[model samples]
Target: MEYPDPKRKSNMFGKLLMAAAVTALCIIMLKHSPSFSTPTHFSRHEKGVTHVLVTGGAGYIGSHAALRLLKESYRVTIVDNLSRGNIGAVKVLQDLFPEPGRLQFIYADLGDPDAVDKIFSENAFDAVIHFAAVAYVGESTTDPLKYYHNITSNTLMVLKSMAAHGVGTLIYSSTCATYGEPEKMPITEETPQVPINPYGKAKKMAEDMILDFSKNSDMAIMILRYFNVIGSDPEGRLGEAPRPELREQGRISGACFDAARGIIPGIKVKGTDYKTHDGTCIRDYIDVTDLVDAHVKALQHAKPQNVGIYNVGTGKGRSVKEFVEACKKATGVDIKVEYLPRRPGDYAEVFSDPTKIRRELNWTARFTDLQESLGIAWRWQKAHHNGYSSS
Candidate 1:
């Protein structure tokens, strides 16, 4: 039999292909319209377990997020260099999960490309919650190189690794340090980000890079600029068990715990001359769990080629003296406070508006009551007096 006209067949095929393309594009627009902007159907794993990579999982907030993730039924892989992280936090998590694939820990640094490569290759992660960075403002100012290398360079490495591994979603643990002394009372996401110190500068660099990277790729990036992150797991299990030998007794809440427990002579109140209700700095402190909940929500809201910048806090500013007073009341001890000069790069009064994260993510800091959160922290510190020391 003679075949039909080849040109006619070709034209028919072209018409069918055009129709399919139009249908797909219509579906895309429908899904992405303002009404469907908030996707109810989230990305998932083959076995329905969303695998997440938590860099710096042995550190303070990282560990807490990891624990929260595991509880939320996400498979977690924790990577830490142990430079500033304590293995004790990992021990606590391992004791709780006690499963191989459910929760795994890798002793690696984000600065090491080879290490990052191995991690991304082995684990099929659906998302990455990046908490690995040099976090001390004073230390970042003194050693700017370390901050740049760790925060900026290391974060870039993580980004590249995720891109290579085809992981498109990232929950970046940023800081209000990027805001750098906002002139306003409650800092909004639109506040001017003029970092005074190297730490904030490094974070700003990373944020810019991440935003720029998303411009070229299909990555979904969520940058949570955290204010003062205080409080523990509330169950006294996962708290700020910073390495005691490292002397992480400088954080306001931790210092209060130490002073109350006599671990430190007194909680040093830095900068008794700032322009605030009290002569000390004011910061918006959010519970670690609440902060991680925002992370989780960001992950849920993530879409291909999406970028979200949010200020994570309770929106209420608390002064240093007020925090000290709350600590005293929480621990039932008159914690001594010694006034000291304000360190460089210190913001006069920094808090959050939180209206964006609240309206969008439907999240609010439920456990941000200063005294109540401090009470939980005091209990944790009192129990783990040595901060998970083998001694």
Candidate 2:
């Protein structure tokens, strides 16, 4: 048996007190933190849906889906407030077709009951493609009330209007973030959703509410939980606008443009030294074109029993470092990179299990790979230098 030294005991006591204080502080912070709180493995067919109402149709994914629907000769009507979506996207659509009666856009917020009523009155839409939710994970984590109000409550309003208007089918824009940190790699539709952030919780809540509605009403819904949606439209007419959170992602395109202009600062690598092969967070990123194609299918063939979930992603995973290197090769630039600590709440690896869509919808991703997709993104970004921004 040994006696504790007085000095050592004092130091140990002090350390324990400090640790306790820190833990208490953390507990208090978590308690005070603003908080907020899918689709299936299958989709099917219910015929006779012609007119489609695309909420947030002016947004990146929604706009692309709108364009695809129009090309397929489906009458498309868009409702967007131009909050995150760009008016420029609408103008581009107008310019691209230059034809009347293909698509209609209404600059209205669904949060407004009057606007919802007006839209319902104006068109006999058979289905709706909703992409109107605020999506930044960090933002939702900080301001959960905002996320709940905009995505959940506002979405409830939209659904109420849809039910009133007899719109029976819905294709929801869900997120992989709803799954939070996965227990396994390449998360599947069956993965238990344990979202760590309010944004994810809100999305999950919305899905639950929609399902609850289905139990009562004659509603057919397809929930698509998308992983990372990267790349641009192959036509160069559509692409993701510059959002504050994804500025670094935009930098890949910017670096490409700069290289094309004979200047090169390369790219910035935010984090590295993770468990991934390239020591960075790995994610499954799908091309936007492929994503839009999947939406088109969901819209075309959605049966009552088809109300299920699908993971829209390239089955393969790519680390952030790998993605940047691919961007460099795609742009033919030896991009420079600087590593920092991993971003808060960033997972070491998260990807999708896309087998359900492949087996059920007979839909598999086609067209560009990551490198090729980045090439297209680079082109579109360079072409539309200042035409749009995501605020």
In order, what lDDT does every prediction score?
0.85, 0.77
Candidate 2: stretches off by over 4 Å: 1-49, 243-268, 388-391
Instruction: Give the per-residue lDDT of model 1 (tens digit) for 1-391.
Output: 9989999999999999999999999999877553455422122245687888999999989999999998988888889998877899998899999865678888987888987886776567899999998688877777899999999999999999999979979999899998887667688899999999999999999999999899899888899999888888888787886656545424777778877888788877779888777789888888888988999999999888889999889988888888888889999998777898988888888888999999998988899789998888878877776777731
The CA-based lDDT of model 2 is what? 0.77
Report the Cα RMSD per candidate: 12.9, 20.2
TM-score of each: 0.86, 0.80
Highest-TM-score candidate: 1
Error in Å for residue 295 of model 1:
0.8
Put down candidate 2 lDDT per residue, 285-343, tens digits, no spaces.
88889999998877767886447789998888888877877877876767666677765
User: Lowest lDDT 10-mer window, candidate 2?
Assistant: 36-45
lDDT of 1: 0.85
**Model 2 clashes, total count:** 7
